[model samples]
Target: MKLLRISDLRAADIEAIWSLVGGGDASLRGTIAWSFEGNGIRTRTTFIQAFRDLGLAFTELPNLLKTDERACDLAGYLDPFYDAYVVREANHARLAEFAAASRRPVVNAMSSQGHPCEVLTDAFYLHTRVAPLERARVCLWGPTTNVLRSWHELAGVLGFPLRHACDRRFHETLDKVTFTEAAILPADVVITDGWPQGADDPRWSLTEEHLARMGSPMLLPTPPFSIGRELAFDPLRYRGFAGYAQKQLLLPVHKAILRHVLSR
Candidate 1:
């Protein structure tokens, strides 16, 4: 009956989960289905392959663009058949309601409030590549979107130093989180989500100049990045940059979720 939020997990819990993922192949019982509003091609493909590798039946519920009520109804209908429900939607409140009503464990694929799976994968990647979660100086450069919110949640749970550099308009929306307009220097990891629509501010964009100011840090850009907006050049050229597509992270994340579900 536990809601899977990053804030609810302890540092030991995260390490244990990642350890399980690293060990390879966790026990997953019954079927899994993904019901999403957005086109999660990468997510769906990665998860389907993961499930196939694990010998589990996986289904992608045909983009059921339902209203909040209909989505909850669908969740109720699928509760008996599926062991786990992975949902991505714009409505965070409705998703919470659906999770509460579901008999199975609910995974927040993505929501307006947070993107826990992405953050979890990012954390694991950082722990392995950059530094331990406790020691890593993380800097998030973008609006106070769901991705940033999840990072904030992770920072709260793991007690990591997470700095933010965004416009003042978006800064006020972040609760109890302080950010600066000045450049984010001396960072161990520099991450960014997509640029806000209609903002059109070059300062907010993660260009070559900003990357230079950040020194030699692990550059991790969230997927679906634009050339002119998110980055000035192709990230693939940079040795430190994690690739544009994060489909590979999905396997570890799914394994971690399965481990958590089995443990419960």
Candidate 2:
């Protein structure tokens, strides 16, 4: 999982992503994934340089969820995109085709269905630092992307109950998943992140009031927003705090999770 193009991230955020990758295993030392804009030679050249330096595969994909066919077509190029691709908010049929077509594994990437890797890591992190996954009440606040998909996947796999709070527009109908518009409620695990959008301004945050509403001990992967201040310091408020499963470093996390699942 070298590269991704979720609208939730920006070019500047690439540094933090690099940090995670750089600190990962030597097997992934050179793997790279990045967002692309097909402007002209300069943009392509820059992207090439970045990949060359990082020793990663390259790809260009539309960041928005507009047409299914276009998304499928774009995802079909996973070989050129990345050694392992993560197609966020894409169609599962397209993902299946990409996986079938590519000799290399194209992870569920991401769709409305589930983000297996994200959930795996989130559950692993929670299990490691806080408590058993099955013994927790996880609360998710945000839209239906890899995050919510992850929650559903984690809950199903670990036999945990998950409650979701998202704006109506981003909410989807699912049998196992329950949705609500009210503010986030506390649970054993509380994960909150933003909707993928054009602008990634740090000011868009879940307020202190929102945080106060949670009833139980918690885990926050990344906070609800990307403010300049570090969210890790607020440990006093929440019993056990963890950064949101860093999706930026999805490659290593994805690979680890894939190995875990496929190995089984």
Scored by lDDT, the top model is 1
* TM-scores of all candidate predictions against the true structure: 0.87, 0.52
lDDT agreement with native, every candidate: 0.72, 0.48
Q: Summarize candidate 2's per-residue lDDT along 152-264 as a digit string, tens digits.
A: 65455344567886666656665446788865556776676545654233333444545566654564744244433223235445545553334333444444433322222
Q: Candidate 2 overall Cα lDDT vs. reference?
A: 0.48
Q: Write the per-residue lDDT of candidate 1 for residues 1-264, one digit (tens) a residue.
A: 333467667777777777777556644567877677777676666666667766667677755435445656877788888877666777777777777767787777777788787788888888877688778878888777778888888887777667888887777534435588875678887888876567667767677667777786778888777777767778887776876544487787767666676466
Assess the local accuracy of residue 37 in candidate 1 as a C-alpha lDDT between 0 and 100. Answer: 72
Clashing pairs in 2: 2-33, 3-33, 186-214, 186-215, 221-243, 221-244, 222-244
